[model samples]
Target chain A: MSASPNQATDSDRSEVTAGIAAVLHPAARGAAREVPDAPPRGRTAWSLLGLSGIGFGLLAVSIVVSVRIGTSGVSYGDLGRSLGSRLGVAEPLPRLLDSLIWDLRVPRVLMAAVVGALLAVCGAVLQAVTRNALADPYLLGVSHGASTGAVLVVVLAIGAGSLGVTGGAFVGALVSFGLLMLLLRRSGLDSVRVVLTGVVVGQLFAAVTSLVLMASGDADATRAITYWLLGSMASARWGVVIVCAIVAALGLAVVWWYSAALDAFSFGADTAASLGINVRRTRIMLLVVTALLTSVAVASVGAIGFVGLIVPHGVRFLVGPLHRALLPFAALAGAVFLVWTDALARVSFAPQEVPVGVFTALIGVPLFLFVLRRRGEL
Target chain B: MRITVEDLSWAVSGTGILCDIDANVTSGETVGLIGPNGSGKSSLLRCIAGLRAPTSGAIRYETSDIHGWSARQIAQYVAFVEQALDSDSDLRVADVVALGRTPFRDRWRGLSHTDRAIIDAALAQVGLADLRSRGWKTLSGGERQRAHIARALAQQPWGIVLDEPTNHLDVRHQLELMRLLTDTDQTVLIALHDLSLAARFCDRLLLLHRGTLVATGPPEDVLTPDRLRDVFEVDAEIGQDSLGHLTVAYRGTA
Candidate 1:
């Protein structure tokens, strides 16, 4: 490298000048016109759709198989007949068997799928929105907030049953989200602040939950709350399943619509804004949506763990990081994953019936490490 | 597009970064913004690019006030490249370039045929057509700068603003990037720390001292030795190189 411009000869400078001129000449300007019709990059739209079709097929199969795997000895034929009869296409089963399948098993399987999908998509969105790989629904404090609300309701004997707990959880989740926004009001919602503030709020709520539970002095209620905290699909009913399904679908749609904006955020907020994203508005909307979805899920299932955190990382590894493909694929992969995990929890210990959250971590940790290793980030 | 900055001023926390600045770059002209550190060069460029709102006055692109436009609408006409921008995500070069078309497409649509063609053209223009599939992490500093420039080209913007784009480049790459910018027909407003490069490559120079525009004219007039001492706090000689280009030779700090 030449440190002194004074050493340059006129010929050397002229050569550089001529080189630039040749590169910028009108004939060379056609360099762009001569672009060799290169093949498209990454997966084509049809291939992506085909892959999504496979994922959906796998989820459907998982749900049906999951509904059949229990101590009741329900056969595949019985499962089909039950579904067909509900759809009015086949003969109805006996009263007890129909109630068992329709009112319990089917809704429980569907609820697990819905909850899993919701958590996974929320995780992926939060990870991108916050630029933090470790972000998940639990990290947002919404789950702990819900637990605190449900704990308070239970200890006080509000007496509206599960509905009262659900209502309390939703309100608690909202309060935590409100606090997060208030704390971030002057901070511009940057990634570090968002993640640290979320952790702080979650810790606060967790402490409150523990304090209320210890102060109540009711062993039975504490045991019940403890089981709920570990999360289960045992209480899954058609009403809650339907409500969760609707919210998850709408929320996923909202997040997916901002897929391009998420891509822009890869270079940080200033670049994202320069690329035409309304940075503040987009971040707020995404945060609110993710928090709401997590609230609805936590209220019903009592904070199922690992699915949101691990599923998105796994999906990103599989399909790359473009959120349009990443979000849907994550939803499908998560739904299938949870349906099977819930089934394993139900039958693994048989009469003991271990919590699904326990199985998720047991399975999720190794899978996450595998993904990290494959991505060369381990 | 011609950019007009009329009585523009900006402040942060009640301290003004740019004060009562006024300048204009006619369509297809290359203007260099030269100033020492903290002299409001980047601030003025950001205001013209519509990234920051001015505390007073206005920036107009041709006939329209850009402050009244959406970010998308502003992006369609003027592309901005900051001094340092990088990403940690697993985005390919082509994926980053495709981001340039964001303002044209809506949420319901994917890249159109025309969008692909334009992306190809942009890559070719920046000599990165073959490196389109390369991961961002794999690129060297100069290649990354070219890729960023390619992204700006993909926007098909009529005017481009860059702030100290050659900061980390080697001498050869710095010269090449300057040549590339000068060759482009788009109106260019760039901030440069290298007085010699700015003098040779840019059509006109806008010189700043503190928050005010101290000089604006051809390089020979703006790079006078006395102004260099007063504004840059350096004793320097303005001379012509063997190639008959204006050259600023710094003697020492004042």
Candidate 2:
């Protein structure tokens, strides 16, 4: 297999057209910071981040060590020395292992982790912002919004050089966010109203996405659409890694800025307003940030769902709602989750790929529900 | 620190709620607002806190019209602890109290040392220091009410508007909370359903009936048998308690 992580192999890279310029993001806005007095809420946030980072670090090292062991039998002595040769470290061996790690798998898995982090962090924010446990990229219509934009690009046959599917998706998600905010703001910043409105918008866009997919030409188009919905990191490259990183960092920064407001929001709007938050502005900015985060993740992997919704809730169980703690922990949990999940995807059935989205939803949903059940809810 | 309300009126939609009501609170005094349901106790508090926009009236805080101040600006001067809704589950005890610093904390930075100390003090004041790490939703009804008060205390305001702060508090916690307000230098306007607590704690009482100011004076003068019968639809005997404090006993019929 010619699949690589740093940049897509020629066959995989063929899926995405080139020359899309990356977007520059604004400095941090609307982060949920720890209250001046809130002792950092959770040991879990720190433990989650620490444990997951270690897990990924160990796994990455293992993958590198495994490459040197060989396909035949795991050679104990040659493992370190053989790996050293492949990485061009220690001494050059007969074959290169560094190439296998850096180019073939490392970047791809890392991107998967980052993408997962973005989705999960956004999910946490979206759930809090909307005050809906069920809220996520999938439920909020953000993914649908992005997919709508990407599908429009596809139907128009506009390739990467022209605004690109990513750009389209970002705009679509943002537009949906604006619409939801307007609707919810007018209806009284009630939590149930926001969730219900998101549902309506999600349904509307899903209908549009289906119509577009149904009308598209050939089995190839349908297959592409299905794969996109299921999500994958087949198109990871140095350029994508850079762009997505910048965007995700920007979104997280914005979320950090709004941490105080989010703290207020966890109580109802009246309580938040009494806390001296500029509720309208805070709400608008948070919606915008979560939407952008969701869009960027959607653009890269194509509509992965439960990671965003489930990851944050999981983090909250360990940490708490102080978004300052929640957002960062959620981001880390998400990153670690996707990395391992993608690894499972790679190993579960070799050669023919299963979309990472399927596994995430499958794993995240039951797990999140279990957490909720423990907390005494649906 | 002094608050003056003159000719205040408010209406929701086309229906009138509070009509031409006037009240006042001097600095360092606790003013109890007593009224039956639909008598505009909450509406009046909302107007005082600038949560509601009153028509054709002036609420002045130290000679500046409070009506012109934004909610955030008002929050700097006044902390309003409304009745606790179902306790906010996502917040821990300390976090709930620290939110009072929402007016003071920088948007993105961690809380200042002073902010942390004050939050600690507020939690301790409410006897909830031990519950600091406990979730807000798990607290008992009385505890949640106290937590909300602690949140208001975090604001460090000059005036506090409390809408039935004793609503969910048990009799003991209610007395404790009410007594907690006695030492405050800030002017406090509290809405109370229990006239006994009001008579015990308040220096002055503002009685409203159907959005009209029925009486504004000390509890001794305001809690008259006639006023109780007319305003609350109950017959009551009003006299001095064993401690020589004015008290009231409700009878069977209006």
Off by over 4 Å in 1: A1-29, A36-43
Clashing pairs in 1: none
Q: Top DockQ: which candidate number?
A: 1
Worst 10 residues of 2 chain A by lDDT: A20-29
Error of 2 at A87 (Å): 12
Residue B249, candidate 1: Cα error in Å is: 3.3
lDDT of 1 by residue, B17-70 (tens): 999989999888999999999999888987888889999999888866777667
Regions of model 2 farther than 4 Å from truth: A1-107, A160-164, A216-218, A373-378, B67-71, B88-90, B235-241, B245-254
Tens digits of per-residue lDDT for model 1, A21-52: 33332323576558644446445677888888
Worst 10 residues of 1 chain B by lDDT: B63-72
Judged by DockQ cut-offs, the docking class of candidate 2 is: incorrect
